[model samples]
Target: MNNYLIKTENISKRYPIRKQNARPDTLVGTVIDFLYKPVRNLKELRNLSSAQNSDYELESYIWALNKINLKIKNNEKIGIIGKNGSGKSTLLKILSRITKPTNGTAIIKGRVASLIEVGTGFHQELSGRENVYLNGSILGMSKSEIDQKYDEIIAFSGVAKFIDTPIKRYSSGMRVRLAFSVAAHLEPEILIIDEVLAVGDASFQKKCLGKMDDVAKSGRTVLFVSHNLESIISLCDRVIWIDDGEIKGDGNPLQIVNQYLETINNISESQIDLTSINRDTNSSFQFSKLIMMNQNNIKSSSFNVGDDLIIKLKYSLKDQNLLKSNLQVKISIHNSTQTEVLNLNNEVSGYIHKLINKEGHVVCKIPHIPLGEGIYSINIEAIINSGAADVINNVGSFEIIPGDYFGTGVPNNTKANFYCISEWE
Candidate 1:
């Protein structure tokens, strides 16, 4: 018997970009071209007719996966980490047999299941109950097997009341819940998951993470992908870092995660450039920049505990809306674990009335930074007419370091998360 359940040898996938041409001068020309086009286009026919067949000359291919080689042993839990468009999902798709590799081979020796996206294998018109069996059949399970797991799946999803409801009527969160429940309960030999967990609420996210931890402990092979590095560290024993369609590093989770965070920090600019960001089409206002200013009003990204920190948000409105009456600005602070630590909004603070310009600025002044030593993220929300005009997540991250806030030189205990001012009896 082979010890490795999954093996890839120089696996590569290339997607071809169809030649884009401008629209024809007339509708008749477009219709004629569409209806009378050759089965093989002229360029392809010419290439095939030529004996030399200079196929390498074509530059219309994007390499989504590049020479990905791995020997995943049976029952070894793995976490895949990468930035957006880094080909993490592409690799998972290849492993899940959703797509074929253009080059090389990948051998799998067990049943595979995946939750790559919401409603991935579901029919929107079908009821949730019907989709459960449909998905089970698609996973190659027999009717008897589906019957055995049906109750467990429905119970875990917490949508038992709506089990007979059409999936199209379900919200995005509900769809994710059912999809994840089915994928997790079906008991496949290999389970592949993507970042779809981000769709769930905080409690559900924690529950799903715990279930994944349980699944890994059951001695099954699991390949998980997420941007939450804290969860990755907690769940995975081994981590694989993918970047630009290639594996950059693969080893211990802590070491790889630390290295990846360092790379991200190095690539990050000193300050965020918000003006270049494209606003959503429905946005009534758009954010420009988020600046961190010290007590002296100098811009910076680092601050010490107990230091007064000012967060300045600059934005522009689409029309002349009174800032004091029509606009609401909200700011949320989140730790590296992606947990919200604090939130502030104009509705609660009553400070937007101070602004008097179309180009608006809201400054949040903290008498003393309450957070301990760690990196924190800022999320900005702009609301107009009771609707979200603009929102940004993880826009700018700053670091809080230890300082002599108290008379004693000893640093405050970061584990406890706060420094208490007390009197010695």
Candidate 2:
């Protein structure tokens, strides 16, 4: 009566690295270098290659996954979140059986469809139409089954025009669209997707999310990894936060996302170094620092209710043409629970409509900080007139202390989001 579809018992994965610079890969170069280099180095290389590949001590290795244990039930929609190199993709690769673990075991009970990369199961020499049948066969689907879904897949992918052409000529976006359409339609018991969907256009990404929603609704297990918190919150029932190749937190999507956001607060003494943040989005400008100021004009991360709060973001343009471009700044404020409490944008505020220079700052001021006594974080984004230029989530955080917002010794409505300045009848 066990419903668990996936189980990993202390699963770990390690990758070896060269003790020094990597040895030359060309056969001729390797032989020449061995003859020219010191004999001691050659002996070391021989010993390194002789040991078992699983042996962790033979050479320096990175533990991509460390003692990870998980049990996922059928039909569960799980979201995975982490900073770059935090092993989110590694875990997905292990679960998909593309990579083996180093120290533990994973037990999977059903068919898996993984869209981890473009052209994952495709052959470059094969036509798109042939690759569809080949990929379906590899997924254990019958030819008849693939034929039944073939038109739908091609239609969804919008690649029907090139179905008979070799996939080597397909662009990355086209390949991903076709791959995702096939994987989602193949009726696999479990589906795994990485952030490669970010390569698609906005409309296609939306289509993929909608298709994933349908997949989850059809009583299949799904493991998704993405930096889009809003999409994760909408599609995932549970979330796991990974840090340094270890599970930092796992539970409710909202709560775990909040926990992950807290750690992204690199701001100190009211200044955040944006270069230290790991962002996945592209941009024509890079952030330099984020500074918060109180009404007294002192930089601080703590403010009292009803006090004026000022946030300033400094950035440098990567392209000089962007200076003349119509750009805007958008900021979102989230409560400690990761629920967005406020969203502000330059277009709405009538503040920064365009850039005046290649390097400068944007300022946002709230005359009265209207928030209950609690901690909150800030998410900042720079957008061109066309699309997003840069996005930095949870870049800064601030705390609000209790204050007499009602202009009396006793404050009004202390439990809600903010106090209401009212005189009761």
Candidate 3:
């Protein structure tokens, strides 16, 4: 059975710049209205404006959505992605009836339960329990319906202890989790979520995304918008690229993500000139750029299991005491959870303070980076005179990659995130 739960035609919804004005009409005014109304031509008065009523008037008034056309079948998962201010939230809002489109109509074919914004329509004065029932009814759930799912919502939200407390006192993450639980348990045929996943910390975000996976599997259409490319690729089957109120591309998740990345990286590398990285005239101490030495190792998008890597820092000192500076660099590597795996520093061995040679350009090398294959960033600082003055931190971003030294099948569903050449069993 082919079912199209949502579809849109060449649907157009237009509005004028000025609303039509009406005035009090007496019998005498009515007599004048009949005579002057013909001469006035009220239709002409409502013809948008001189330059504002073009077929594409989006230039003047913000066209939240323009000529959007797509047919989504039941249970389809559509992921929306774009840069900030690219109409992603606007599209979701239009579909949710939060706001009407300025120029195009969207035809939705199922009941929608949305968590576009946290604490939407939640009463600040109401307790958590009252708000749950209030929000549930707002989502079309009857009182009995809300009672049936109350326990599950509280459990999934991890707010059973606070379920009776006033939500006005809940933390940001707690509020988000509760709101999401209410929306998820409503069991509407269509679910739309925005970047709420980016609200909480890594672990809570993971739990929310996992819950969304189950919600989608229960035969509900999902339209999710997120900036996390990793999450988007992992969760979405098809991706839509919306830019400047138009659909740029729609295709497989990975391809769309790769295209978006290439576009962003190219712009970052091109438009943001890396040269002239810094300028500080006080005491003559400054660093310009920090980047990976062998970028080709990373550019190919593949890494071997045990490849040596180095992070290079390029800076120039106008004038300084090279020996008195006593340079030091601190580097920390973190996992996906932002948990520190290693905090390698040259302070203990005094290697960092040792690199104060004229300060034109310097490279800090992690002799043998003891970590698995994954994305990592550095926190760099330069301290002078026994941690007295001169400090620069996270100057630039770099990564330590795990090389596929062992020719094994692609790693999946395994905790084998690390690849080290150590003697074992």
- Model 1: number of clashes? 0
- Candidate 3 or 2, higher lDDT: 2
Q: Which residue pairs overlap in candidate 1's backbone? A: none
- Give the candidate number with the greatest TM-score: 1
Candidate 1 — worst ten consecutive residues by lDDT sum? 47-56
Candidate 2 whole-model C-alpha lDDT, 0 to 1: 0.79
User: What Cα-based lDDT does every candidate model obtain?
Assistant: 0.76, 0.79, 0.62
- lDDT digits (tens) for residues 50-121 of candidate 1: 412224554344566789999999898899997655789999999998877767899999988887875567
* Rank ordering of all candidates by lDDT, starting from the highest: 2, 1, 3
Error of 3 at 418 (Å): 24
Worst lDDT run of 10 residues, candidate 3, spans 265-274
Q: Score every model by TM-score.
A: 0.59, 0.58, 0.54
For model 2, the stretches where C-alpha displacement exceeds 4 angstroms are 20-56, 121-125, 168-172, 269-425
The TM-score obtained by model 2 is 0.58
The per-prediction tally of clashing pairs is 0, 0, 7
Q: Sort every candidate by TM-score, greatest first.
A: 1, 2, 3
